[model samples]
Target: MSIDLKTIKHISKLSRISVDEKRAEKLAGDLNSIFDFIEKLNELKTDNVEPLTSVAETTLKLRPDEVKSKNIREQIVKNSPQDNEDYFVVPKVIE
Candidate 1:
């Protein structure tokens, strides 16, 4: 799609931006150049290309998940401002 001066003016007003006549014309030209580049890219043929995460092949290292600490609820609750039987209590944060 082509960008016109009227469209740029409307967009500037909606975004609370002040663009004088010269800047508005300049922006329209820049936007038209961007659209022209996109149109050129659309002429390419890529039917057999595979999407890639990276240009090179590699493996991600991972560690085994294991429980390493015993439950210490009572000791932790001692430092809190308030606590019930097995939980710590704090002020409500959301409405």
Candidate 2:
């Protein structure tokens, strides 16, 4: 697709950017170049090519899931200023 000054102005307005006529012309040229490059890339045949998720072939190492500590809620809750059997009580700040 071709990019003109009008298109550049419209894009600048939508993006909340201010652009002068000279800058707008430059942007139009730059956008046209980018679109041309994309068009060239689209012309390449890739029907047999597979999509790659990662460049590396190695699988991620995972650690075994196991409990490392006993239930310590009662011991920890003893240090709190105010706590019930299962929760900590805090001052109400909101209505």
Tens-digit lDDT track of model 1 for 17-85 = 999999999999999999999999898887898878998878888999898777877778887788676
Clashes of 2: 0
Clash number by candidate, in order: 0, 0
How far out, in Å, is residue 32 in model 2? 1.2
TM-score of each: 0.72, 0.74
Best by TM-score: 2
- In model 1, residue pairs whose N, Cα or C atoms come closer than 3 Å (at least 3 residues apart or on different chains), thus clashing, are none
Tens digit of lDDT per residue, candidate 2, span 49-74?
99888999789999999988799889
